[model samples]
Target: MGDEVPGVGAHARYVPGRFADQVALVTGGGSGIGAAVARQLAAEGCARVNVADQDMDNAESVAVAMGGTARHVDVADADAVDALVSGVTRDCGRLDVVVHAAGVDDPEAKAQLLSAREAGEPVDVLARLGDERWRRVMSVNLDGTFHVLRAAVRAMRPRGRGAVVTVGSSAAFDTLVGYPHYAASKAGVHALSQAVAKEAIAFGVRVNTVAPGPVDTAMAARTPAAVRAAMEAAGAIGYASAEDLADSICYLASPGAANVVGAVLLSNGGRFTV
Candidate 1:
């Protein structure tokens, strides 16, 4: 893992031109692991990188920094996702890799959990999980991955070679008692990735999922202190940086993972054996 991939990105094993002449698209590239992945792809000499995100400002900033293009896309909108993949393919002439990382946590649910913890109140997490909150999480986290993966697979299948890495969550398997919706959505993403990989592999398109634990991202920053502490205590290496998760993601998207398909690569730094 420490080996250098020079052209791929910083802090990675150096393999000059590992991604040269390739075209890649990273959803949620506005920040966190997605942003790191975009930068890595650019460093690896990808001919074109499309940064798709709901946050226009963040997306633009990352794209400009990496010398890539920014696209304002909400993966929940299947039509919009389709157009994004089509537009990228049309412009780049081919799509070599895709990293679907756009996802959301229910703010209401998180807020309730935090408030309850601070107040020492007994809060029923499930009862507070309203229909709207649950739906929103599912739409953005699960359906969004579906839209991106569907479009990406279609765009790459004809070419007979491509790699797709879906960013999932360790919560999916470990179970986040306070955020069932978030966990369920990510679980769906993992299952979907495997299902798609089963068919996409025949076309030479590999699909995989990366389930990351407590990384230093905005989402994790807002976690309850108690929960964060517990998670860190469980992990052998404590919290991982966004770049650390990006390394795992980029490796899966690289040729180094050509034989890896439908595998959920857990990157929790030895947190929770199960």
Candidate 2:
């Protein structure tokens, strides 16, 4: 089975039927951690999976592979997010789980910092970060999370049962020197998730966050070598794979986490101590 499955490991275990008859929506399902979650949900027999992403090509590919539906949505837009949720609920008759994994980091800012360091100039990220760059990162990582979470919560509230697992960053709690924008945005995400979890759980909806440390992803691949090396060493397990994150995310979205609410599950591989 491992030899036949593209991304599956030789020892990977799947809980077939765990999500059977349930519908799921995964934002940023085109690639990386989101893609991994989408695949896992399908493997577990989710009735309908909505793969929402801005990149339609990648989204469509993953959707096709898992027999899910691909949706084109830029999560930073509230109306788009609302429509995505409504459409899924309207079509599928229910939305049992939502994994909000769409987020962005400031690679350009990291590049500038690295370049300044190489030239022996004092690197002040705040001084160098442009207003537009900072806003863009916040818009995607923080605002996008807000839009998705709000819309999902509303859709699930009426049902009286649902789960939402959002992807956060360990950087939210730690200092990612050159990425103040990224850190700030993710911090907002963590706080927002907890606040909403309190309210949403009252409606029998569960909202939680999975804060990951250094994960080997396409975004990570773009980081400057110096920055990448620091990240690689930051995690005790070197670096986690996107699939590793997916595993944690799926658990948070499953019945196993039924009693868990307003929690931030750190899947950072010992990057930090709570």
Candidate 3:
């Protein structure tokens, strides 16, 4: 852990060179991994952080806690995302980093699928895996990422210097059944980062991703004990903390990663080597 520094205003505090003087925008910054990222960046001396999420209360809470700005914008909405990017730049002057961490995991569907597995039934037999579920998952995880990345790159490219870090999942590489939508969306995220890196490099902007495995967040905590055990067995170190993943996000966003591009840094405790 690092010591906390003073904020730019009476409500904010600064961390140090980890992100000193830089402006960062984080989606899904209200809770889970997103909240951790926001706290870490704010601690690292980021001049301003815009914590955007569809949940205004959660976003505002995180913003107030970090002493940063909070905005309500659904990443799935292109216009909302565009306005958000513009608003941040106008208010904060410039944007240096963008971290996409918003995601959804349907527990009911997961539980139903897991039950089928327990009953020795074919996983695909479960009706929980429906078109609506798939669409909802993709809309948030895949399409939402595209919305944010497109908007951020537009702003970042002109500046000739910026960093974009998308949060992916170990499931993208490993065998995590029952949620094909989540897996597919994460796969798209990694692929998108690779593509972005190739194009952004010419403009001095770097793009990378961090895929975490079995992190000890609320989402993972909601998993059944058996499911959690299975996931832990796949990891070399059992489980990871939100801070562990947050550190990787910050690293990819910092100057130290100038030479690192299109890299998918895995902080999965050796669960999946990619």
Q: Write down the worst ten-residue block by lDDT for model 2.
A: 2-11
Which residue runs does candidate 1 get wrong by more than 4 Å? 1-14, 119-123
lDDT for position 172 in model 2: 89
Candidate 3 to native Cα RMSD, angstroms: 3.2
- Candidate RMSDs in order: 2.6, 2.0, 3.2
Tens-place lDDT per residue, model 1, 31-149, is: 88898888777876688989999999999999987689999899999999999999999999999999998888876776777777788897668986789989999999999999999
**Tens digit per residue, CA lDDT, model 2, 17-87:** 77888999999999999999988888877888899999999999999887899999999899999999999
Tell me, by lDDT, which candidate is best. 2
Ranking by TM-score: 2, 1, 3
Residue pairs in collision within model 1: 3-13, 4-13, 4-14, 5-12, 5-13, 5-14, 5-15, 6-14, 6-15, 7-44
Each candidate structure's TM-score, on Cα atoms with residue i matched to residue i, is 0.93, 0.95, 0.92
lDDT, model 3, position 205 = 86
Worst 10 residues of 3 by lDDT: 5-14
Q: Which candidate is the best by TM-score?
A: 2
Candidate 3 lDDT over 1-274, as tens digits, reads: 4556343122222235678889999999987888888888888888898998889899888889778889988887889999999999999888999998988877876686678768887776235477887888888888888888889899998889999999988888884777677888899999988998899899888889998888998888889887788889987799898778887888888888889999998889987675
Predictions in order: lDDT? 0.87, 0.89, 0.84
